[model samples]
Target: MDFQNSLAFAKELDANDPLARYRDEFLYPQVNGKDVIYFTGNSLGLQPKRTKKYVDDVMKDWHELAVEGHFYAEKPWWDYHERLATDLAKVVGAKEKEISVMNTLTVNLHLLMVSFYRPEGKRIKILCEEKAFPSDQYMLQSQARFHGLDPNEVLVEVKKRKGEHFWRTEDILDKINEVGEELALVLMGGVNYYNGQVLDMKTITKAGKEVGAFVGWDLAHGVGNIALELHDWDVDFAAWCSYKYMNSGPGNASGIYVHEHYLGKKDIPRFEGWWGTKKETRFLMQPEFDPIETADAWQLSNPPILSIAPYLASLELFDEVGMEALIDKQKRIVAYLEFILGEIDKQVESTFEIITPKDRGCQLSVFLHGEGRSLFDYLMKNGVITDWREPNVIRLAPAPFYCSYTDMYNFGQILKEGILNK
Candidate 1:
């Protein structure tokens, strides 16, 4: 489809969008009596209109049923987390039994590390991408320290070269082979947070496996933003937060995936909890932990029904829209944004450069050369909800579910005006 940087053309695209009705499903913050062009779905998604009702239903269950809500509520609290597994499996491209909704992203990463990041003897190093999310960096450092190893020596990073903004697949694979003998784990973000570069997870995972290293992914940005095949790619394990593209509210529950090969392996080390025990005999209170036979074995506590409710509501929309339709719209919206930005570049002597790679998701990170934070502030004052990174990058995302093509055109206009005025 050809893209045009005009309001009429943008509206035409919106008119033909099959998922246009979904914009009405969410509530956006108002700016001067109009909805702001929100482009920060890469950070926090807009709230779904049905989220309140979902929360209220859980509140009502607690008020009326109290403790009995565990087993007798409309959707029993005892197994509430289980409700999301099948839908999440479809989103992540895995077997239903291979996925589970559990604790927050980092906590689940730590739990999975206990089972997968087994550094021993000569193979104690961990490989990862450079400039990872701070939380992931801290987790990796602490995990290495837990095994009495120096983080400087144990951690290896795949960095961008001289003037490059992204890592090459061949360089990454070559690094995996170079560190083959000593590498114990290969943990990376499926999509880079700052630049929105979608890494080739399948090839990377295969390279790590060939070197006999455990491979995992932090899919915080990858989960709902991109199409994935964790099972088909033979990923050892993966974890992600629900608040970003999943639109489950801030600090919501997370989802995890473990390959079927590790399903019933009792020998795998994990921090066992009663909730992870086999449900049939869970009430018996057996002294020894008898783990479940699937990915649910990693669960440490009972489901947080209220916190998980919004995710269920959002998941219904995902299931209704489906990945095929969602991605089709995603590509179109991204292409339109690129086209509009390119026109802005040609019209003005702009200092900004789009550093995001071609293989990307909804986000496009703009590097403001020698510019200060004032340009970003101007956009904020003018009602463009984008994310500002330190130094000088503004990350914007036009989420397919809620953002219209007109939003992209307006953002490009505002951005052009801001740059020129500054």
Candidate 2:
């Protein structure tokens, strides 16, 4: 498809877009009384218009049912989180029994590590991408320290080839083979937050398992943005926040997936609490811990109903337009965005270096050569909401759900003006 850098062309594309109507479902931030072209969905998604009603229903139930809300509310607060399981599973490509919505991303990662990251005497090292998200780095470091091992000795990172911005699959597989018997775990972000490169999870997971390592993904950027089959990939465990592409509110609840192999197993070592027990036997208040026959076994406390409400609201959208349709629009829209960037780059004196590789989702991390922070400032002031990384890189994620072709064309025009003005 030939993309043009004109409003008419953009509108033509938008007119034909099957997902165009869904854009109005979200509420965007305004700049100068106009909706900003939101390009930061990788960081925080726009609030779905239906979200208010979801939260309001929860509040009303809490007001009316009081102490009995757990059992008497329309959705029933006791089983509210359960409502998210089926649709959430569909979004992430996992069985309902393999998915559980619970704590925040890092918290769930820590809890899952207790069950998956068992380091024996010879197999203690963990492999991750070099310079992972700081939170993940901190989590891995602390986990090693908690287990009485030097983090430097226990955490091995697969570095990108010198002068390359993205990691190569061969390099990761080679490192896994090199770590060999010492590799106890292989855990990394499924989609790199910096370069927006989608890792080959299936190949990597296979290699990790062949080396006797437990493989897991921190799918903070991968979930809802890219295609994932955690169950079919044989991933031992995984966790992701709901705020990014999932469109749950800020710092909302998280979801996790554990392979069916571990479900209903009493021998697996996991930190247990009342919520992890079987619901039927939960009120029985028996002393013994009876784990749920699903991924819910990892849950600790009762879920936060308010937080899960927005999540359920967002999942409704995902259900209405499945991931397959979303991905179709994602590919075309991102391609159009890239075309607009290239067209603008040709017209402007400044150079635009896109660091995000072809194996990416929606995000395009471009390095603005011969430009500075002021360019980013100019964009924000002009209503092009984007994410600025260190130096001169700006991360633009044209989320397929709400971002339109016109937003791409308009952003190109705004970008050229910013560069020419400089």
Which digits, one per residue and each the tens of the lDDT, describe model 1 over residues 1-422?
A: 77788999999999999999999999999877889999999889999999999899999999999999999999999888888988999999999999989889999999999999999999999999998899999999999999999999999999999899998999999999999899999999999999999999999999999999999999999988999999999999999999999999999999999999998777899998989999998999999888888899999888788899999999989999998888899988988988888888887776668888998989899887767799889988889999999889989888999999999999889888887888
Q: What TM-score, over all chains together, does every model reach?
A: 0.98, 0.99
lDDT string for model 2 (261-379, tens) is: 99999999999999999999999999999999999999999999998899999999999999999999999999999999999988988898999999999999999999999999999
For model 2, the local distance difference test gives 0.95
After superposition, candidate 1 runs with Cα above 4 Å error: none
Error of 1 at 120 (Å): 1.0
lDDT (CA) per prediction: 0.92, 0.95
